[model samples]
Every structure is written in C-alpha cells, then in structure tokens.
Target chain A: MPHISLPDHLPGITGLLEFSQNTAAPIRELTQILLRGDNSLTQGERELIATVVSHNNECRFCTSAHTAAADLLLGESETCEMVKYDLDNAPVSDKMKALLTIAKMVQKSGKSVSPEAITNAKAQGATDIEIHDTVLIAALFCLYNRYVDGLASVTPDDSSFYQYLGERIVNHGYTRLPQGYDHLKNS
Target chain B: MAYIKLPDNAAGMRGLMAFRPHLAPHLGAFTEGILCIEDGLTKAEREIIGTLVSKLNDCQLCEGVHGAVAACYLDDNEVLIEQIKEDYKKAPISDKLKALLNIATSVQKGGKYVSESQIQRARDLGATDIEIHDTVIIAATFCFFNRYLDGLGIDPIQDSEIFRQRGRMIAKGLGYAPKK
Candidate 1:
C-alpha cells in the first residue's frame, strides 16, 4: 500500500514514473543518456556505478533493478555482487575501484567525498568526464532511491520481475512504456 | 576551487551544467518540470521543500539559490522562508505544509527514514497524492543537486544579492532549462 494510489502492474520506480508523467519524461531521458548513451565508460560500468550507489543507500528495489541490469550487461552476476559487497577487492581495473570509492563517498554525503579521492581517480586513468559521469550517476540514483522508497511504492516480491526489467533496460533502454499502460495509472 | 576544471564564470551548479552541455538540458528540464510547473504544490512551496533539503544537506549554494527563489514567490511572507528553514514545524504555515516538510526532512536523512505515520498525517491534513508525491520528489532531487555541486567542490557565490536578482528572474518565469 503506497502512500499514493499508484498502479499495481508497474512496480518500484516504474510505477512512480507512470504516476507522474511530466516529471518522468525528463527523468527517463536523463537516465537513458547517462546509462545507455555513448560514452568513454561502458554501459555495464555505468550500471555498476548505479548499483553501488543504490546498494549504499540500502534501496532494495533500486539495488535489485540495477544489480540485475549490471549483471546482464557485464555478462556475470558475480561482479555486481562483488562491487556491491566488496568493491575494494572487486576484479575491476584500478580506475573502476577508485571511481567506485568516490561513488560510495557521494552516497554517504557530498562533503564526505575528499579531494584525495579525485586525485586518486585521476591517477588511475579516470578522465574528467568519467569522474563527472560517475558522480552524476550516483547522485541520480539517490534521487531515484528516495523517490521510490519515500512513497512506499510497491516492490515486487518476485525476482523474475527484476530479470525481465534487466533485459528491458539492457535492450530497450530507459523510455516510456508502450501505450495502454495509461490504463494502469492510478489504478 | 572545484576539483574539476568547471567554467570560471559560472558558479556552483551552473558551472557544472556548463561543463557538460550535452547533459545540461535534460537536468534543467527535469528541474523545471518539478519546481517551475504549477502542480498541487505551489512553486513557492516546492522551492521551500528544495531549500529545506539543501540546507539540511549543508550545500550552501543550493540552499541560498532556492531559498531566494522561494522568498521571491513568498513576497511579504518572504521572512517565512527563513522560518521554515530554521524550523518548519514551528513556522506559521498550513498543517498540510508542515506535514509535507516533515516528510522532506526524513527523506533528507535517507529514503527509508520516511515513516508511514508521516504520510498518514499529511493525508489527514488534506494533502493530495500529487502534493505528497511532489514533496518527496523535490526533497529527493535536491539531494542529487546538493551532492553534484558539493561533491565536485564548486564555489558558492558570496553575494546574496546575486541570488535575489536571479531568483526574481526565475520567479518571473526564467525557468531552470537553458535557452535553446
């Protein structure tokens, strides 16, 4: 039972997005550009950043959704779990470890991110754009995490739903759901 | 003294947005949609929510910028913006706004900190679903903005008058989106 009457069919952020289409439009666009758009960072790497931040925030729905997406894009579930639980020892490159450290700091508090972290990331070959995108992705997921959980939106108990969502995210990217989903609004 | 080489002319979030032009429009549009659009929450109330979150997050730039915008809309009630920032619960405002601000505070701490009793209280005070939804979104979005600006160590504008002038322009419909 969400605080607001959201649709039953769409769970988590999807339902909240549908309920508020105006805000949802730009939000979807932002997510698509940050996650799926061409960049120096691979889509998998970006999803990893999102997963790590969501995990730090303890947002169950977001952590599950992005973890699944990351697993698919990276072609393994092990790495996502590794990044979530033990990022320091995760089998990623040194650059990714440094970047994830910054992401974790951002998740804690903006002030928590020290100048040393930025220096370390740069030394590990993380470019300015990569650093910029990493922080933006982390910050964006914070917004998503709070939005999804603040409303007490429904989180599907079924793991299969996350698998389907992971595929859709990897294949279709973030966009508005197809038509007839309008019937689900406020339902 | 930003960690990155953000544009020198623009300060705070503006500098960061200018640093990444391709992503700026979407971020701007989203800000416009949530804060500028007249929904169940008035633009003043929405800005108030954003200001409160920024203040709590200790992002002086966002707190000052949005607080000025909120004050611009509040006009004679401009002082009330500070009151809300200091303590919304004790401030003279509708019970509905008080309830919504409480929710915003919890969200500033963390998403899971928002309680069921808070939502129920807002509902009892006649807050619509959209109002509650907008309140949470505004609070959440500020968390993003605050971190983005602060995480990179963007410098805040020292002059309060600058924020007031910008706030008036925004209040007069110069929305968050950069002009095409």
Candidate 2:
C-alpha cells in the first residue's frame, strides 16, 4: 500500500505520476529527453546506467523496470544482472565497466565520483556526451527511485509484468507509458 | 583543480557543466524552468527550498549562491534566509512554506522518508498538490546538484559579493543560460 492513495492498479511511479499531471509533465519530459533522447550512449547502455543506479539505491521498482529495458535493447538479461551484481565480474567491455563504476559512485554521492574515475572513463573512450549522459542517468534515476519507493507504490509480484512493460517501452517510450496507464485500467 | 581541470571563472557546478558545453544548455534550461518559470511556488519560495536543501546537504557553495538568489527574490530578506537555515519551523515564515520545507527535508533524507501525515499537513496549510510536488522535486534536484558540485570538488566563492551580484542577475531572470 502506498503512503497516499494513488489511482487503482497503477504500479510504482506510474501511479504516482497519474496522481498529479502537473508534476508528471516535466518529470516525464525530462525522462524522455534523458533516456530516449539523442545521446552517444545507446538506449541499452543508458538504461543500464539507470539500472545500476537504481540497484545501488535499492529501488526494486526502478531496478526491475530499467533492467527489463536494458535486457530488451541489449538482447540479453545477463549483462544487466552482471552490472547489477558486480560490475568488475560482469563481462562488459572495459569502457562500459568504467562508466558503470562512475555510475555506482554517483549513487553513493555525486562528490564520490572522483577525478580518477572520470579519467579512467575517458581513457576507456568515454566521450564528453557519454560522461554527461551517464551522470544525468544516474542522477535522474535517484529522483525516480526515490519517487517510487518514497510513495510506497505497489511492486507487482510478477516479473513478467516488467518485461512486458519493457518491450512496450522499447517500442513507444515514456510518453506512451502514461497512455498505457489508461489501457492498463481498461484491461 | 579537481578531477577535471575547469575554467577559473567557471565556479562550482557551473564549472563542472562548463566542462561539457553540449549538456550545459539543458541544465541551464532545467534550472530556469524549475526556478524562474511561474508555477506553484513563488520564485523566492523555490529559492528558499533550494537554499535549505543545500544547507541540509552541507553544500556551502550551493547554499551560499542560492541564499543570495533567495535574498534577491525576497527583496534582500537576509535575516529570513538566516532564520530558515537555522530553524525553519520556528522561523517567521508562512505556515504553508514551513510545511513545504518540512517536505523538502524529508526529500533530503530519502524519498521513502516522506510521510502521508506530512503531505496531509501541507495540504491542510493551503499547499496544493502541485506545490507539494514542486517542493519535493526542488529538494530532490538540489541533492543531485549539491552532490555533483561537491563530487567534482568544486569550492565556494571566497567573496560574498559575487553571490550577491549573481543573485541579482538571477533575480532579473537572467537564468543559467551559458554565454557564447
């Protein structure tokens, strides 16, 4: 049960956003721009960054949601799990590992993302845009994770729900998610 | 002189954003939207939330700069800003604002920290849902900013006058647009 009443059947932030459209607009707009907008990082990589931060923050809803998105785009779930479980042990590239390391630091404290980490990411071929997006993705997810968990929104017991939503997200994206809320209601 | 070499003139978070001009514009726009755009909270109230959260995060640079901005928006209400930082509950502010600040502090701790009672209190004190939402976003965003600036090892300005000047510019709706 959420701390406050949200629209019936809506899960996590979806319910929270539906509760107030005014607050929802900017947040949705920002999410679209950051996650799906033009950037050097692929949608998978960006979603992975979000997943890593969400995991670190211990937000199950966000972690599961973004993990599904990452799984779809990357064509594998193991990569996200690897990044989530242990970045170093994950079989991602040197560059990706470096970026994930920076994301983890951001989850701890923005100040914790050190000069050495940036240097390491750069050395591994992370561009300025990539670095910027990585930070924003990490930062944005913190907001999102807090928004969902803070409200005490319902986390669906079924894992397939996330994967189904993920496929829908990979096709249409955040703007469509709100409309899908109504469809979810009808269904 | 931190993780990345920043321009001498680019101080604090400005310096970090300056390191990447491409993303700088978006951040500038977001700040403008959050603080300058006419919305649920007055510009001064938004600044108050920003300043208070920065103070809570122990981010001197953000607190000082936003305090200057809040001072400008509040018509040089320096004492009020000081009061808010020291103890907003007893501070001589409207109950609505105090309630919003209470919510902001909850955001500062963690999202899960905000309670239904707090929301109900803000609503009871004439705070609309939009106002409460904006306060939470402002507080949460500052956490990101404070951490970003401090994470990058950005330091506060040595001169208070600089903050005053910037505050005036921001108050005049100059916003965070990066100059060419």
Report the number of the highest-TM-score candidate: 1
Give the deviation of candidate 2 from the true structure as CA RMSD: 3.1
Which residue pairs in candidate 1 have backbone atoms (N, alpha carbon, C) closer than 3 angstroms, thus clashing? none
Q: Give the TM-score of candidate 2.
A: 0.86
- Over the stretch A94-167, how does candidate 2's per-residue lDDT look in tens digits? 99898889888888777678889989999999876677668767877777777777667788879998988788
Q: Looking at model 2, give its docking quality level.
A: acceptable
lDDT of 2 at A144: 77
Supply the DockQ value of model 1: 0.86
What TM-score does chain A of model 2 get?
0.94
* Candidate 2: count of backbone clashes, pairs at least 3 residues apart or interchain: 2
- The candidate that wins on lDDT is 1
**What lDDT score is found at residue B119 in candidate 2?**
85
DockQ, all models: 0.86, 0.41
TM-score (all chains, Cα) for each model: 0.97, 0.86
Segments in model 1 whose C-alpha atoms lie over 4 Å from true places? A180-187
